[model samples]
Target: MYQYDNYDQAMVDARVAEFRDQVARRLEGKLTEEQFRPLRLMNGLYLQLHAYMLRVAVPYGTLSGKQMRMLGHIARKYDRGYGHFTTRQNIQYNWIKLSDAPDILADLASVEMHAIQTSGNCIRNISSDQYAGVAADEVADPRPWAELLRQWSSFHPEFSYLPRKFKIAVIASAQDRAAMRLHDIGLELVKKDGVIGARVFVGGGMGRTPIVAPEINAFITEDEIISYVEACLRVYNRYGRRDNKYKARIKILVHELGVEEYRRQVAEEFAHMKALGLNPPREELARIAAHFATPAYESGLSDDLDRSDPDFALWVDRNVTAHKQPGYAIANISLKPIGGIPGDASADQIELMADLAERYSLDELRVTHAQNIVLPYVKKADLYALWKELEANGLGEPNLDLVTDIIACPGLDYCSLANARSIPVAQKIASRFASNGRDAEIGELKLKISGCINACGHHHAGHIGILGVDRKGTENYQLLLGGSGAEDCSLGTITGPGFDENGIVDAVEKATDLYLRERTEGERFLDTYRRLGMAPFKEAIYG
Candidate 1:
């Protein structure tokens, strides 16, 4: 909900004009495809397998209803009638035409949104907890810091081109909803002696090599956060690998340097940055923080849900979360509806969601990294009516973190870099686990699938991870177990062998069956896996 200032508006408008000219030149043959590649990528345009794809940034996953409505308009007018919400909380249009790229961007700029840094080696969109301002456990809202970083990093000359792309995530709650440890840089807001500060985690990422970020600083005062972050980035920018593209992320650099050495280097750089006065002034941070003030919540609304309807009760239990405000709840809108595509929303559905948000959720909505939307401030008394509207519009499915709620990527179906198809595999697995009673019995399970080792689906963080691969020109999948993307972060270990598509689905079912048999009371699949280790599950999956 940060409103663009006059300066912000002017900058976006200027960028749109610049891109329009660039697109015209490309179309007129003044610029070849090779010449325009980086230019296009800098603006979040990519040439995929079938068509051009455009990724638009959703800063810290927060948006106004008007912004959501514009997204719906773009989906309907520019590309296909739907858009894909990604694991990074951005949205993508998969069937874009080069000719309409500028127009699409212009429309986005009209609403103060853009595709800048959504791709490219620059700092990508900063992410944070979807329940940022309203989470009961939060020490402070992380979005203000995330937004500050966004402004500081945008078009930064020093970091315009790093060895590889960089990502940052901020989390204020004890629960790591933003996958804090899996980011290049993670900041956890902590309080001591009534003063809020940051705990910095460095060099965590997921790709071919997945590593959880190690804590670099136990506490840095909020006033010095930008200095510390700049120090970390400067260190990585200077010494991170340029020899090999595959080994270019900060995680690789940290791995090679050892955490102790990396911490030492960062400390040295932080001292220099501080001496040079690179940190933003406290007043500037206070100014940015003012934009994210909590909404005027109504008093005396009911905290109790009218759960007389079993379906409503089920949906409430599965989809609603406790809110910091009294008589209000955070409602998660499930994009994964039974066997549908995991993170896609049609124009109509998008518009309907926007309208619903405007009417009920204080005109604000949040995109979750798990590919769902959050109505962050819904009154409990209005729950049933909102549920009815959402269900009617095909936007209501009560599987929040259940087995069938799978996270998957745009695999071989759209991504040229993909070696195998992920959507069908996700579809089949969700179908296999579609029984409501069975899913409820199974409890919370995180299943993620990726088309390749790029880990776009965050397979490394799932309780059950499936990575699609091409073996002798045939699609095969590798299964992994015991990974999580929470505060207790760990990478999954692979099972014995890869499986064909059907074999993988059957294998997942078998693995779940084994879990059900072995699990003690109150243990989720992840807990059970940690308790029993991979031996029994490996036997069940491979044997």
Candidate 2:
């Protein structure tokens, strides 16, 4: 719900004009592919396996109905008739024409959105809790902090190109909906002594070398968070490896330096940054915070819901969360339809989601880290009607956090970095669990799939993770267990050996079967895995 001012509008429009010139030059053969790679990447364009892909930034996963409608338009007119919402809370169009990139960006800029910083070595999109303002237990909305950091890092001269790509996530609630600890810098806003401060975690990432971010600062005042973050980045940028891409992440540097030494260097940098007055004035934060003011709510609204319809009641139970506002609910729209792609929403579905946001969610929509859409403030009275509309449009699925609700990256189908196909694997596994009604029985399983070890799909953080690998020129899948991206975050461990496509799906079911058989009362797959560890699950999966 943050509208772009004249300055913001000017910046985006200028970028569009600049990129148009660049694209024209490339098409005219004045620039070669190598010459255009970094330039195009800076604008969030990628040369995929089949065609060019464009990633549009959804800052902190917040957008208005107008912005969401424009995304649908871009998907419909420029690329194919669909867009893949990514784990970064961004959207990607796989079949893009190089010539149409500028037009698409222009269209995005019209709605106060741009693809800036969605790619390249600069700080990627500053993500936050999808339920930032609506969550009942949050200390404060995290969007303002996200936006402030966004403005600071957009084109910072010092951090234009880091050793590797950087990611940051902010969360206000105790729950880790944004996978805070998995980001390069994770900030959890906590209220202590009646003042909101941030608990900072640095150097966390998932890739070939997965690492849980170590706590750098136990608590830094809210006013000084920006300065603190800048300090942390300064240290990483100075010493982080640049020669080897595999060892270039801040996580690697932090691991080598040790947490204590990293903290010490950051403290020195923070001291210098504080004197330079890098943080914007208090009024600037207040100005940014003003843009995210809560919408007006109706007084004396009834909190009653009609549970006569079993399907509607089931959807409400699985796909909705309690809103801080009375008589309102946070409705989740699942993109993972049985046997369908996990995050690909057709242009029509996107437009319909935009309509629902305007009509029911105070003109705002949020994209979750799990690659789902969320209407943050749906009225309780409107649940049935909303569910009916979503069901008719194939958007209603009561499988939130269930076995069928999978998270997958664009594997060999789209990504050049992928070693195997992820979409087919995700599809088969979802269908395998859904056909026998087993998905409903196995509850709260966070399943994730990645085509390679880059871990773009976050396989390292799933309760049940599948990694696609190249085994002797054949696509093989590795099963992982006991991973989680929640408040209790931990990396999953690999099972014995790899399995072929169908074999892997069966292996996942076997792992789940062990959980179902061994779990105590009310234990989810993750809880059961932790309680029993990997021994039984490995035995079940391998045997």
Candidate 3:
């Protein structure tokens, strides 16, 4: 994890002080709600349907055990007894008091975390692969570059207020674990003739208009990524729509102007940015990279796992992934327990995960884009003990990428923008599939739900997607199929008419049933869907 230096601490402390005064003014009636909207948004505070929601940034999704412990403390002491880990690898507290906002920011500042740039129409928290440094296929750890971008964009006067909110993600592997293409700017570190460079993609996003960003630059040298990104943002910031808030994202701009034209504009801006020496010196990146240096590993350790217990063995097979280092595994902790809310962990569960991280995972943990946690450096020998502890707690769910591991947003239950309730929909579906033997049979399914077209749950990228809408003042659900946020990116297509809340769950089951009956050997749900097309699934669901 990147430790906050005096400069970083000073910046955060100053923001806390500034926001403290802003909150006080609002409470004291010196500032009205209209006046305090942007001020509070800049500090990651939102006035939700019920109350205030605070989003705290977890840069590149990396956290120390102590930092994770502090998150638990905040949950226990402040709002509710749990926190919801989001699709962006950030965490949110739903019920927050206006009075305690500053105190919460101060508490976060103490642990090198903050709520800055989380809610505004600015470059939000920088995201990356959860398995960044430990993934076997990584070209390089993307976090250093992510951190560099974080420093470059934080409170940047030039991009302080863009036409709309922008998001950026970095990944070093070919497998798009971070949904790299589904970001405003996605950077993939690639090696060209033994020298690393970045392959840049621009204009990808999901909302009312979903798009997989087209590649802008095939390759920019290692030293030029930041400058190239600046150029990309500069073009969007210059020409991106300001009239309609709906079409303000860079993705929409890139769509209006063809990819070739967008590419040309970026190239023109790149030349100017390059001439101005916008790229930081190589030493600064090197200094940032040093913070993500690999941890020491015990040499000649056994790679064998004692999977004597069938239950533990099932978890190992489902939740554990191969690591770059020998005798190590990446153990995914599923926050989506059956019948429970997806991406949520109670204070005790959070604290237990922190303890597990310290005791078994090099004192470091990562939050995955799927709303799960990763112990990136777990020893294969200690797998059973770790599994036992997690199982004893509620964190040990053996479903990873299965139907039960759902992705959903805070719908009408929390979000004011939502049309229908998303939590109950997710809960019903998860409960229906919990005890069914069919979920494991339907392997590697990515099911996502969103309360509205905002696509906060990333429904546009799911293999099976559910979108809740308001039809004639009644809640309705739409089923979408064949979407993915992986290296092979595509948006899901709607399956004809919408259904009621319970009807949608049954519709999903019907679609999966058709898959199980028709799929060829070794075919995943997505592969089968892509092979058979939507007609069959639509017929099965609608009929």
* Predicted candidate 1 versus true structure: per-residue lDDT over 1-543, tens digit per residue: 799999999988898899999999999999999999999999999999999999999999999999999999999998889999999999999999999999999999999999999998989999999999999999999999999999999999999999999999999988999899999999999997899999999999999889999999999999999899999999999999989989999999999999999999999999998888888989988898999898899998778777899988999999999998999999999999988999999999999999999999999999999999999989999899999999998888999999888999999999999999999999988887885366778989999999999999999999999999999999999999989999989999998789999999999998899999999999999999999999999898888
User: lDDT score of model 3?
Assistant: 0.94
* Tens digits of lDDT, candidate 2, 1-543: 677889989989999999999999999999999999999999999999999999999999998998999999998998789999999999999999999999999999988999998889999999999999999999999999999999999889999999999999999999999999999999999999999999999989999999999899999998999999999999999999999999999999999999999999999999998888877799988999999898898767788998999999999999999998989999999999999999999999999999999999999999999999999989998888899999999999899999899999999989999999999999998889889999999888999999999999999999988899999999999988888888899999998899999999889989888888898999998889888888888888776
Q: List the residue pairs that clash in candidate 3.
A: none
TM-score for each predicted model, relative to the true structure = 0.99, 0.99, 0.99
- Candidate 3 segments whose C-alpha is farther than 4 A from its true place: none
Range of the 10 consecutive residues with the lowest summed lDDT in candidate 1: 432-441
Candidate 3 per-residue lDDT, tens place, 1-543, comes to 799999999999999999999999999999999999999999899999999999999999999999999999999999889999999999999999999999999999999999999988899999999999999999999999999999999999999999999999999999989889999999999999999999999999999999999998999998999999999999999999999999999999999999999999999999998888878999999999999999899889899877779999999999999998998999999998988999999999999999999999999999999999999999999889999999999889999999989999999999999999888988888888877777888888999999999999999999999898999999999999999999989999999899998899999999999999999999989999999999999889878
Residue 370's lDDT in candidate 1 = 98
Q: What is the lDDT of candidate 1?
A: 0.93
Candidate 2 CA-lDDT value: 0.93
On a 0 to 1 TM-score scale, where does candidate 1 land against the true structure?
A: 0.99
